[model samples]
Target: MPEDNHSTVTEFILTGFPGLHPEYQGLVSAVLFLVYVLTLTGNVTIVFLFATNRSLHKPMYYIILNLSICDILFSTTTLPKIISKYWFQSETISFTACFVQMYFVHYLGTVNSFILLLMAFDRYVAICHPLRYPIVLKKSTIQILSITAWVIAKTGPLMLVIRAYPLPYCASNIINHCYCDHIGITVLACTDRAPYGFPALVLAMFILLGSLAFIMFSYCSIIIAVLKIANVQGRIKTLSTCSTQLIIISLYYLPRCFVYLASNVGITFSPDLRIVIIMLYSLFPPMINPIIYCLRAKDMRESLWKQFNRRIFTQKAQVPSVSN
Candidate 1:
């Protein structure tokens, strides 16, 4: 296709949610809107709690703050547009907007994976080398690592989008998901061979395989160190921390690995399965992260409750004073 021909394609259609009957658009919208709201509120609350609470200033909480931010970005990037598409049947996205959305989706997704890997490393250092944990995860070191992860996550995807979007999109440009996913967008390309396709594949491999491998290695070391503790109570306490980190890491990463690898392998999922996977990929992590951290970590749980009570009392106090 010529450049002029490609320029003629102004916007792309998103297939909305697959398997949702047109008649049920209202119901689907209601349900999805509720989910979107919950996701936003939950993740935002965690971010606020992490930021305002001075007690949450440690390395682990710092990473939790990053995770919360990533969750908010991830959900915002995909869900609201999906809800609109399903409800209003407005499926058009401009080429430029689609590229921007794709870049953020990939960036946030990769960042989420990298943050989880960092969390695993944090837990390992805490458990395996308790005395050195503070020194190792100092504010300066944490800042540098966080910046590095963001850079690593954004670099490849941004480059890929720059290369991919300029190619011809003369054929059908309807993406089949809520947002502009790489696989869905690739299916819409007029060219069979994508210039950015190989780079995307490499990035995915680095994130999915490389990150997961590093996390697993960290956990293995953590488990070994925990086992060697002579005191049973100490061993249990150490294992509990590692176990919570492991569970959240699995919930966040495994689905991602499955989806990315499946996409790479050309495995086609049904629309319902795709939606479910996307929900799991986007919503579940944000919803579960704070819950896991609060429940498993005593300090976080107390701080959260204290923060909640403090807000409630402050509001009550202000109301009485205003009324008086």
Candidate 2:
């Protein structure tokens, strides 16, 4: 296509699960709506609990708070539009809007990886050098690190937008994925896509593998430290503290690595199956993170219990005495 032909495309249609049978759209939409609701409620409740409770105002909980906020923002960014796509057949997104969504989808994803890295570092310090943990991860230090992660996450996505956004889009505007992302958007550029696609791939790998490498190392160190503890009960207690984070990290990193790596290799997936895999890694973690915290983190568990008990007591107190 000629350079002059590039600016003709102004909007994109998102085809959510392109291979889905027409009859299944209603079911898929319902399920996605339910997931969206749960994701918001769970993550929002975490934020509310953290804000209202003084006991959770600590370094670990502070990291969790950032993760919760990212999850809420992430789900909000990607979910509603897809739900609308499935329900109302409202698939058209303006050119500017698609890029904006693309920015946030990748930006928040990068932020999440960084947050998990922070979490792994937190556990590593707490376990590997228990004596220095408090001094090392003071409130001010944690706050600074979290802010840095948020700031740093902006680079890759901004570069993506800068590189890919202005490319001539004389090709089709129908995005095959559920939400706008770097690959989904750049593939539609009318020019040779390799120059654009390769850099984005490198950036994606840098974020995923860089964070995963550090996280793996941190957990390994934690494991070594736990093994050095002679007391069986002590080892178990220390390991329990990190169990939730381990699960969250796995949920976030494993399938993502698989998908990204698989794509680069010769492996191929049907468009619908690929999107399904993407959604599994993307949506499942945010919905499940709060549940993991409530079940695994002692402080969060205690706080939830206290709240539950207080609510019960208030209800009981409100009941009228019936005996004569």
Q: Count the backbone clashes (under 3 Å) in each candidate.
A: 0, 0
Model 2 residue 80 lDDT score: 96
Please give, for residues 1-324, the per-residue lDDT of candidate 2 as tens digits.
544324678999999998899899999999999999999999998998899899999999999999999999999999999999878889999999999999999999999999999999999999888899989999899999999999999999999998788889976998998899988888888888888898888898899999999999999999999999999999999899999999999999989888868877979998888899999999999999999999998889999899889999999999999997
Tell me the TM-score of model 1. 0.90
Mind giving the per-residue lDDT tens digits that candidate 1 earns over 204-283? Answer: 78877888999999988987887798999998877887777788888977887788779879999998788779777677
- TM-score list, all predictions: 0.90, 0.96
Clashing residue pairs for model 2: none
Cα lDDT computed for each candidate against the true fold: 0.80, 0.92
Best-fitting candidate, measured by TM-score?
2
Count backbone overlaps in model 2. 0
Task: Report RMSD for candidate 2.
Answer: 1.5
